[model samples]
Target: MPLRTWQTTLCSFVIAGALVGAAGSATVTPALAQGPSAPADFTAIARERMPAVIAITARQRVRERETAPALPEDLPFREFFRRYFEERMDPREALGAGFVISPGGHVVTNDHVMGNAEEVQVVFGTSTRGPVRLVGRDPATDLAVLKVDPPPRMMVTAWGDSDAAEPGSWAIAIGSPFGLGGTVRVGVISAQSRDIRSGPYDDYLQTDALINRGNSGGPLFNARGEVIGVDTAIFSPIGGNVGIGFAVPSRVTRSVTDQLIRTGWVERGHIGVSLQELTPANAQALGRPNEMGVLVAAVEPGGPAARAGLRVGDIVTAFSGNPVESGRHLSRAVAAAKPGTEARITVFGDGRTKELA
Candidate 1:
């Protein structure tokens, strides 16, 4: 499904139920009995993290084409209308959000927000800082790092262990929705490890938080006010918040942003091979009882796999002693590896098992 930018308000209603006793007396049940207790007040958490959540305004140069004005069919000016149109270059501004990740002025946000920006500015608590330098951007994860000379004292948010994020856990989102700065919204983690097909490393944390267009590149916080995810996209049909939004997990964000800050670019290990899921038929053909691991569909010439003698029809059983459960597992494992590091690869092929390094 096409993902839309999220923005708007959420309406909620309460339904009360009554129980009747044998004496015809009605008893009212507590609303909390239906589910978990009311969530604790997020006011403290929001107040603490709101300062770090900054609004971003990116300006880019764009081409604007002028359309010819309509003319009457019988009017002699119809042919002259076509000659008056022209294209002009103009500046366009895009608004989004970001959060400070370090005291030295390192801010983290979505790449799409600042990737194409010619001029970037950050709005923090009524103060605007202009022309923030783009430290680096990783399009694969839709994350970016920006550097600015922050005030003497800046509030920085820490990263939480996103792997600990579970469904039904409380989630808070702070951003500038529709150019409204310092907006706070709360929800629960609806899901984790969601592959929304936004990118190859798409381990997104799904939430019902009120994330919108301007919320992109903002921070999604846990109950402890730690950053757990970076708001990126939303699944909306009406170009507004429908309670479904996706954010890049902080685990991935931390790794990518750290690299981007330190090196201006991300270096992902590449073992050139096309992989497919191991099918039952292929497992049977290979004399295996069950479909496990990933099948090597093709090996690139002169790449790591080719140099390691990996061949077509070979099933990758493990990577550096880690079992490969599926193609995504193998892909993530391989990409996480440092380039130039020798990896122990186990494969099942030719009706036998072999190890390659």
Candidate 2:
């Protein structure tokens, strides 16, 4: 029997466990220059924070042998032997990391880390480990939450408003990579609201911190020890952090995390419209010069865009207050908006510029 509606919808990924930081969290570890002085209380921070970070291991049951209806009663003996020889087997194992966010064993980590996991387990600071049950997950944001009954001593990290994290701010990352437990790396916020083309809402915080395969779902802390981002992906031609790593900003994570913990799902608004970036050639034809905007290629019938009189061949220059330079940006903006809320949009159509709601 399937689990109940809420239970069936819960997230299924594993948390942090024994991550081996190969290149670790730095894109390019500077070997030539002496690094800036370490933080004054680096030891204290690690000692105090490590306990909150927990390793997660997940296992999925793989059915090696599947049963098929036996052939007609007259099946040959040779074929019968072959069918009977097949062995039924089950294999289970997966691993990742997550940090304690709430006192009642609420943990946060990457969604992919737990997807397809049949059994999830969490290891606490005192070497005590236990199975964790999934609370909820959001693949669009690549985040998930798990609940465990951990000791009361689990350390917690405070969340900082990501809106205040500007470029060049100090960033520190902590997590297990490649089965290695508890490693730290430091860098600066290289950029913010960077869309890496990973998902519909790809608003990521770009950092120079070296994030390896095992860094997924870890926290990116501001110098004040506040959580600003959740480490997510890396842009490397070689599949390692080559100085270009991305994290889901706290703004996005906080919203998703709250929804997952409370409602077991994200309620995103959808304004159905297919869009494209305005190219130089297309812009010239449209009498636009040096203008950045997204061109509407198609609008779904009855969607918010269509209902609002949005049509093809129209160029969207802005949504709400943020500039829309590409379709991805517009998609994210629209999805983040409330379903019934009226949106302000700037558009160029039929040789006229207009503001429409």
Candidate 3:
């Protein structure tokens, strides 16, 4: 693959596991980082927090290469080669790392780790190991929750305030890097809220902490021993750690995992209105001279917007008192709202302005 392709394609492929088998959170309170003048004990934080970090393996048996090389021109041994050497792949076990989030065995990891594998397992050091069941996954956020039978005493990691994490703040990552035993690397939060174009919800913490293929689901901790981010991806030309890495911030993980744990799904708020730009033609059809707002292209018969008296041809002027400058703006505003909440919408229709809830 080209280097630019590697840069974009490696986002979800930064995986760790061997050729033997297959592949595939806590919100702690923000432990205030050592102030700008001081440094946190990265070693001490790793020791205290490492116990919560565990290795994860998603089993997929033998699989072939994604694309086989083209056959040689004028090959004489076609039958011999085709029968024996066609797409034979190795047995592999996919391995990554995650952390226990609940004493009852709710674990947090990236959605990519679990992939589509049916068998998933977790191990804490060498003593505690068992299979875990997938509870929920939010691909938009790239977060997932797995449920394992609780050990006698599993150390649950606490979530820290990711919003408080600053660029240049100390960042320590501990996980099963390269599928080796737990490894630790120290760096700083190089940046925050990075949109690597992986998904629509692309908020990520860009860190320089050395995370490799196996570090996808590991924790990135602040100075105070709280998990500020979950290491997820990296930009590498050679598929090894070259410093650039990304982690799902704790704020996104906590919100997603909490919902996953409670409801087994994330609830997205939608007002059920299909919208389009109010173009001159559309406005003329609607018998309006102005094309300043969004036009309701369609409305679900029984959706929230319809129930609130929104209909086709309704011009949505505002949402929750904020001006709806464009269809994209209105869509984002509604999607960001919490489900089950009430908000008034302003629309211009029937030759007058009106508000609906």
Q: Pick by TM-score: which candidate is best?
A: 1
Q: How many angstroms is residue 277 displaced in model 1 relative to the true structure, after the best TM-score fit?
A: 2.2
Which ranking of candidates, highest lDDT first?
1, 3, 2
Stretches off by above 4 angstroms in model 1 are: 1-39, 66-86
TM-score of each: 0.83, 0.78, 0.69
- Superposition TM-score, candidate 3 onto the true structure: 0.69
Each model's C-alpha lDDT?
Answer: 0.83, 0.76, 0.78
What TM-score does prediction 1 earn?
0.83
| 10 residues in a row with least lDDT, candidate 2 | 6-15
Global Cα lDDT for candidate 2: 0.76
The alpha-carbon deviation from the true structure for residue 61 of candidate 3, after best TM-score superposition, in angstroms, is 2.5
Off by over 4 Å in 2: 1-38, 63-92, 239-243
The residue ranges of model 3 lying beyond 4 angstroms of the native Cα positions read 1-37, 62-90, 273-336, 344-357
lDDT of 1: 0.83
Model 3: per-residue Cα lDDT over 148-180, one tens digit each: 888776688999999898998888898887677
The per-residue C-alpha lDDT of model 3 at residue 182 equals: 78
